[model samples]
Target: MIRVSASGVNRPDVLQRKGAYPAPAGASDLPGLEVSGVVEGGDAAAMADAGLHIGQRVVALVSGGGYAQYCAAPAGQCLPAPEGWSDAEAASLPETVFTVWSNVFERGRLQAGETLLIQGGSSGIGVTAIQLAKAAGATVIVTAGSDAKCAACLALGADHAINYRSQDFAAEVLRLTDNRGVDVVLDMVAGDYVEKEVGVLAEDGRLVIIAVQGGVQSAINAGLVLRKRLTITGSTLRARSVAFKSALAKACQAAVWPWIAQGKVKPVLYRTFAAGDAAQAHALMESNAHIGKIVLTWGDV
Candidate 1:
């Protein structure tokens, strides 16, 4: 159990609220996936693995139930909050960081000296990706809906930012890389965007898709994929097993936590609302006007 201080709002939460996405079997039907709070009780083995003490302030990724003052989470999915972070900031870390680590580093296999192209770079996931990829020694490129959003991504250490509304991202990526193309593409938009992303990869590139914000059906040219030796794959975080998330938690601690500690990467919190106004939080998220993360706060912090 955790005495919840704050909860991170995510796109999936909005979908779940509208009855578009259902919780996995046996998981909570509540609309949150991550929280920050004090530990109360959980499996001893998991607590040991996560190095969590009963009173420790920590952030955790959960399947649901983060809207309340007290919630339960798997111990293996928890991590110590970074020093000097507010409850709101700490609450913002788990979902975005976990997603970035699993998809960008673990799945995409992005390495130092490689280039990464991120779709929707002003988002919670996008901000995390830009910082993490840059901290890992990769050149970062991103696309956002507006010029201001593009500028925000560039300010966050993206090497280049394309306003997707006024610019052709594929062409810009090619131009930026001198036609060599990026080595990895972290994509949230699927459907037609998938084909465009495939067109912007270098030989032996990887494309890791984490969301289908556009549409679900996508068409790709098999010949291009074959010629480029590209890999296309994607995963959703909520349905994975406890052991799987536990492994990911360990990996994030090893690879990503240092960056946070060193101040090389940090959470970008847009706004926080009282827990009673969760609907407003979701509305802001759906509006797509805010940058970084939206959080809901409980008073105990």
Candidate 2:
């Protein structure tokens, strides 16, 4: 268990707030995916195997109950918070880090000498993808709603950012790649964008869809899948087996945590609200005005 000091508010939380997504069985009905706090207690043997001790500062990925003052977490899901980082900053790590590592690298098979196109480049997931992909030596192209958001992606080390409001992302991506197309696409907009993503992928490319923000139904050309040997896949982090998540947690700890320690990848937090103002935080997330992660703090510095 953790004495929760801060909670990361994410897109799923917003979706749950609107009655769109439901919490999984045995999870708290409260809306939260990640938290940062002190490890007050847990199964001692599990904690020992995970190298965790009582009073250790940690950021944990949980199925639910992160919004509470205290929450039970699988010991393996808790990672030590980086030294000198605040609760708000540490709270931002788990969900995005785990998602990007599992989807973009594990499933999408993103390589060093490849290009990745990300839809919704200004989102929490988008920012994390840009940094992680760049750190792993991949060229990133992102599509944002505005030029300012595009600039934000560029500043975050994205090789190119397309303003989807003005330019056709598919055409721009094809043009930017000199008609070769990108090696992967990280798409949150799955409906109409799926067809276009199909159009702009290089042979043997991958498409990892984490969310369907643009509606679940998608129409894509089947011929492209056969001709290019494209791999279109997706996964939801919640409802996965503890063994799977524990493995992912170990992966992030081994690969990404070192990046965090060296400053290659930092928490990209846009804002924080008091725990009581969680509704306001959710509102800002829905508005899409923030550039990175949002958090709710319960007085932790």
Candidate 3:
């Protein structure tokens, strides 16, 4: 158990609230998948392996039930806060870090010197991906809805940003990559985007979809997928086994956590609301006007 200090606001929480996305069987019914605070108690072996002890400041990726003063998380899913990070900053890391590590790095197999086209560059996942990819020596290209968002993505180490509302992202990606296209695409919008995304891939490029914000159904040219030998896949961070999350946690502690400590990557905090104002925080997230992340503080801490 963790005495919750802060929790991150995520789209899934909103979806769950609206009864669109239900919690997996045996998971908490409450919304929120991540939190940060002092460790209260848990498995000793798991805690020790995670470099955690009783009363230690740590961040955890919970299965659910993070929007309160206390949350129980898998012991293996916890890690000490990055040096000098605030509770809010630490709180913001788990969901995005875990998602990007699982989908972008693990599933997509994004490597050094590759180019990544992130669909929602100013989003929580997008910001985390941009920083991590850049730190790993990959070129980052992002598409946002407005010029301001484009600028924000650029400032966060993206090589190029396309205002999708005004410019065609596939065309811009081609132009930016000298017509070769990106090596990977982190897509949040599926449906029709699957076809357009397929058009902007280099040979053997990978497309990892982590959300279906646009729509669920899609019609794609299998010929494009076959001819290019592209790989299109996706996964949800939650609903996975504890062992899987534990492995991912270890991987992040090894690969991504160092980047955080070295200042190569940092949390991008947009606004933090008091826990009572969770509705307002969700409103901001749904508005798509805020860049980076929105967090909710649990109490006086």
Task: Give the Å shift of residue 15 in candidate 3.
Answer: 0.4
CA error at residue 79 for candidate 1, angstroms = 0.7
Q: What does the lDDT read for residue 181 in candidate 1?
A: 95
Candidate 1: lDDT of 301?
35
TM-score of each: 0.98, 0.98, 0.98
lDDT of 3: 0.92
lDDT at position 69, candidate 3: 92
Clash list (residue pairs), candidate 1: none
What is each predicted model's overall lDDT from 0 to 1?
0.92, 0.93, 0.92
Per-residue accuracy of model 1 over 1-301 as CA lDDT, tens digit each: 8999999999999999999999999888888999999998888886887788899999999988888788888888888988988999999998999999999988999999999999999999999999999999999999999999998999999999999999888999999999999999999999899998889899999999999889999999888899999999889999999999988988998988899999998879999999999999999999999999999999833
Model 1 misplaced regions, further than 4 Å: none
Give the least accurate 10-residue stretch of model 1, judged by summed lDDT: 41-50
Candidate 2's residue-wise lDDT over 23-107, tens digit each? 9998898999999999998898999999999999999999988888898999999999988789999999899999999999999
TM-score-based ranking? 2, 3, 1
Candidates ranked, most accurate by lDDT first: 2, 3, 1
Stretches of model 3 off by over 4 angstroms after superposition? none
Q: What would the per-residue lDDT of candidate 3 be over residues 206-243, giving only the tens digit for each residue?
A: 99999998899888879989999999999998999999
